[model samples]
Target: MGAQEDAGFSTRQVHVGASTATASPRATPIYLTAGFTFSDLDESAAHFATGSGFGYSRTGNPTVHAVEERIASLEGGDQAILVSSGQAAVTVALLGLAGAGDHLVVSEHIYEGTRGLLLDNLARLGIETTFVDTSDLDAWRDAITPRTKALFAETLSNARNDVLDVAAVSAIGAERGIPLVVDSTFTTPYLLRPLEHGAAVVVHSASKFLAGQGAVLGGVIIDDGRFDAAASGHLFPHLAHSDRLGGPSYAEKYGRRARGQYLRESVAPRFGPSPSPLNAFLIGQGVETLSLRMERQSANALAVARWLEARPEVERVDYVGLPSHPHHALGRRYLTRGSGSVFTVTLRGGLDAARHVVQSVRLITHMTHLGDVRSLILHPQSTSHSGRTVAERELAGVFPGTVRLSIGIEDVDDLVADLDQALDSVASVATGGRRTDAGTRGSEREVVVL
Candidate 1:
C-alpha cells in the first residue's frame, strides 16, 4: 500500500519496506538507541497501554520493524516478527500457542538443532512432540492427538534435501483445525511460497539464504492471518480468551492479526530475544538480492550434484533436483525455481575418505554453516549431527563418509574444478595412485539412490 501494488518480486524486495516520507533515508537506517523519547506523559501512557508506539528496544524498533514488514510482504503474510535467531523465532511462535500438556506433530527430517529444542528443552516444559516421516501423509494424520496444537515441518530438509508436501500436510491440519508452521529456510520464497499452499505460518533462519551471505544472525515469523482463532478456539484458548484486564480476546480485538500480535506483544518480549538494529539492516540489504543469489546457487548446485553422480568414487548423491532422487517429483512440483543448493554426497571410502576431501578442498571452505556466498563443505557425521545417535544419523542420510555441500554463486566451471581436485585426492588414497580419465569424470556411473 505504501508503494507499488502488483509489483514483481525484485521490485518489491528493494522498495517494500522503504519509508517514503520526505527527508527519510532511502535505506532503513539503524536506530541503535536503547529507547525512544516520548513527547509527553499522555503519549507514554498510550504507548504502554496499546503496545503500538516503540517505548523500548526489547519490544520493537524502527529498523527491526522494517525488516519484519519486508519479509511479511515477500512471503505474502499479513504480519511478521523478527527475533534474535531462527531458534528464537521458532520458540516464540510455538510457545505462543502451545504450553504445558500441549502436543505438536513434527517432521522427522528437520534440522537437528530444532529436534534438540523439541526433545531437550520443550519436553522439560511439558510439551510433547511426535515425529513422523516427511512425506507420509497418512502417518501425519494418525500422529495428531486430541491435545495436538500445531503441525510443524521444514519446506526443505537440511543436507538430505527431502522436499516437504506443504499442501498435503496443510490439508491434514485444516481438517483438524490446527495451524501449520513451516520452516522455509532452505527453500526461500524465491523457490517456494509456503503461505500460498495453505500454511498458516512461515519461519526462517535468516542466517542462511535469506541473507545471501553468512554474516548476520536473524530470524522471522510470518503469520498469514488465516489461522482463525474463533474457528480453532477449542484448541487454542489463549488466543480466544483475555486474561490481561477485562478487554476483548486477542482474536476479537486484532481479528486477522491475532497470532502475529500475540507473538510480538506477549511471547517475543517475554523471551527477550530482541534482534540488533544493525543485524536487521544487514539482513534487509541481503533481501534486496535474494532472487539473484538463489537462482545462481540453485543452478550451481544442480551442476555439481550431476557431476558428483558421474564419479565412481562417490557412493550416493542426495540432491532432490536429480531424477534418481526419491523425492524428485515432489521437488519438481513444489520447487519450480530450483531444488536448493545444500545437499549431501556419500563416499565409497568411508570416514577417512571424507576427511581427505574435507581437508583437500581449496575453494570450498570446510565450515559448520550453510547458505554462504562461498561454497562450504562439512563432515556432518562428526560435526553438525554428531550428537545424534548412529541410527538417527543414518536416517538423516549422514554416514561416516557423507559430506554436505552448500553450493555458492561462483562460476560452475571453477566449482567443478575444485571438487574434481578434491575427489582426485580421495581417488589417490583409494587406488594408491592418481587415475585420470575424462570419461570417468564425465560418464554416468551407477550410484546408490535413496
Candidate 2:
C-alpha cells in the first residue's frame, strides 16, 4: 500500500501488515521459529541467494516484517529494518554506509548514549566523526571532509530539546553528495516525518514515544531511497562493491532499497541485534495509538513547560514549544504540529535543588526512561551524561542544575499541580525558607480569578 492512497494515518496503523498467510490471526503473530523449512534444494538455494523469503529468525521473521512494513508506511519510506535496540539501530545504520577511514558529521546535542557510541565505539573502529552545532548550517558544511560519508543529527535532541534544521542540513548533504541520517526519536513519525523534509534515512529509538507504553525495546531504520550511490561511491564503498555477498553490489541488487537491504542482510545478521518477534508485535500494537498519545503528550508537555517557566525556582526551561526557548521559532518552522514531550529545565539552586524537585514529585515518576503513560523526570548530568568529562558534558549543554522531564498522558491540571508543589518544596529548601502558612501548601492549587 502507498501513502498517497485514501488511507489516513490512523487507518494505516490499524490495518497495515496485520494479516499473514500462515495464520488467520487478526493481529500480527509472533513467528517464534528459528528457521523456516524449504520445500526442496532448489527453493533453498533460491531463497539463500535472493533472500526472497525468511530463512532464519536471526535475519528475518514475519512478525518483524509486519512491524517494519508498518513503520515504513508511517514514515513514508521505501523500506525499513527492525533491530534489537535504538543504539543497535544507530550502529547498524552508520556501519551500513561507512567503514574504517571514513568520517561522519554528528550533532553534539544528540542523545548521550548515541554520542558515546559514535565517539568511543566508532572511533575505536577507525571511523572518525566530527561533532558540530546542528542549528548552524555553516558548522555542518565546515565539518564535512572528503572522507565524510554521512551527516547525522537528531530531529529534536534529547534532554537539550534542540531543534535541527532538517531542510538546511539536507541541502548541505545534497550539495556534498552525502546521505543525511536523522534520528527522530523525540518527535516520532506522528508529529514529523524526517524523510518528508529531505532526510535520506530516518531512524528511531522505538523504546521511546514510538512504543508509547514503554513495554518493549526496539529500533528501526527507514530508507528514503533518494541518495545516489554511484555519484558518492568512494564514501559508501559497501554499496559500490559487495564481494562479501557474491559480487552483487548493494545498489545493484536493492536499488532504492539498498540501505534497508544492507542493514537487514549484512549488518543485522553479523551484529546479532535483530528484534524478537514478540517485541516487534508489541511495537506494532504501540504504533496503533501513536498519533493519539503524541497529541495528548505534546499538549501536556506544553502546559508543564509554561508552568515551569513561570516558577521562580526554575532558572530556565528548554522546551522548543516555549516562546522563551532559544529555538522556538526554528521549532515552529520545522515542527508544525508540536516540538516534543521531552525537555529540560535548570534549577536556581543547582544540583541540590534539582534533586529536591525530582524527589518531591508525586505523579511524575523519577526515572530515566521517557515517553511513557506515566510521566518521568531525571537529571542528565548525574544520570545519562555521567560518564562524560566535564568539558564534554558542558559542550553537550548538560549543566549541573539541568533536569529532564518526559511529560505523559496525565491530566494537565494534575501535572501542573504536581510540578507546582515540587517546585515550591524545592524553593523552600533551597532558599532556607520554611513552609509557614496554609497558603504555602495549597496556594497554587486554589483557583483565583482576578
Candidate 3:
C-alpha cells in the first residue's frame, strides 16, 4: 500500500507494511536469508548501483523493511530505517546530519546513554553539542549557531518526565533552517506524532513501548520530508555532496526518505548495526498491539502516580498527569490523552530510603529498563544517571532519593498496593530509630515521585 493509504495511527499500526495480507502462519514471516539473488547480471548491477530493493540482509531485509515502513507510517513520515538498537538509530541519525566540526542543540534531560554518546563519543569525533532546557525556547534560540546542523530532544525525557515543547523547538529549527529531531520513545506514536507538531524527524527506541513486551531491541528513524536539505546544504554536506562520491544525493534519490537512505547507505552499513530479521519480526508483532498496551499502561501509570502523590512518605511525583508537576501544563498542551507510562518519584528519607523501596518491591522488577508489560523500577541517581557527577545529576532533576517507575498492564489496585507496601517499608526503616541524614529529618519528610 502507498504511504497515504496508511492514514490513522492505529490503522497504520495494525495494517501498514505487511508483505502478506494473510500468511499461512498468520504472522509476518521472518526472511532469515543473508542475501537475495538478482534475476540476472543487468538486474544485479542496477540494484547495486541504485541501492533499490532488498540487496542484502545487512543492507536491507524484507522483515526489517516491513517494520521500518510500519513505523514510518505510524509517525506520519515519508520513510524510515530500522537499526539493531536505539543507540544505533540515534547515532546514525545524528551523524547523518552533523559531523566533524559541527554542533547539535539538545535537551539536557535526555537518556544518559544518549548524553554520553553526544558528549563523550561525538566530542571525540569532533562533533560538539550543547544541552539546553527543552522547555525554554530562548535557550534553544541562543544555543543555535551557524554550525548547528540539527535540534534534538525527547518528546518526554526519561526519569525526569520533562515534556518538551515540540512546536517551539520546531519553530526554532525552521528559523535556523535546521532539522528538528525528537526521540518519541517515551510517548510513542500512538500517543504523540512529533512530525505533526513541525518536527522534521522522529526517532524511537522500539526496545521500549513500541515493542510492547521488551522482547526485542530495535530502533527506527522516520523522516517527515518537510525540511529542505538542499537549502541548508552547507550545514549538511552529506546530503549536499553525494554527487562527489558518485552516490545519489539524499534529497535527489530518497527525497522524503533522504535521512533514512543516508542512515541505510553511509551510516548503518559502515557501523554494521543492522537488526536481525527475527528481531524485526518480533518487533512487528509487538507493534500490532501497541495501541492496546499503551492505553492500559497509560492508565496504570496515572493511577500509580496519584497513589504515590497522596502518600506522606513521598516527597514529589513527576508524572505529567499530576497537577503538582511543573510540566503539567506543558503535558496537557502536548500530551493530549495521557501523560505516559514512565515517571519518577522521590522519597522523603533520601538515597537510603530509595534503595529500601527498590529492594522491598515484590511485584515491580528492580531493573534499569522501562516501558515493559511488567512494571519495572530503578534508582536513577544510583543507576541510570550514576555516570553523571552529583552536580550534574541535580541539574538534571535527579535526586538521591528519586525512584523511576515504568507502570505496566497490571491491575491498578495491585500496583498501588505494591507501591504502598514499598513506601510503608521505607517508613518503617526510617522510623526504626536510625536517625541518619539518609533516613530521617526534623520535620515530616515529603517524598515526591514523578
Candidate 3 lDDT tens digits, 254-370:
665666677778888888888999999989988999999999999999988998889888777888899988899989988886888999888878766887888888999987677
Would you give me the overall lDDT of model 2? Answer: 0.83
**TM-score winner among the candidates?**
1
Q: How accurate is candidate 1 locally (lDDT)?
A: 0.87
Q: After superposition, how far is residue 151 of candidate 3 from its true place, in Å?
A: 1.0
**Residue-level lDDT tens digits of model 1 in 281-327:** 99999999999999999999999999999998788899999999999
Candidate 1: clashing pairs of residues: none
User: Of 1 and 3, which scores higher on TM-score?
Assistant: 1
List TM-scores for all candidates, in order: 0.90, 0.89, 0.89
Give a tens-digit lDDT track for model 2, residues 225-293.
Answer: 764776676667777777674887888877767767777788889999978888898988999999999
Best first by TM-score, ranked: 1, 3, 2
- Clashes, model 3: 19
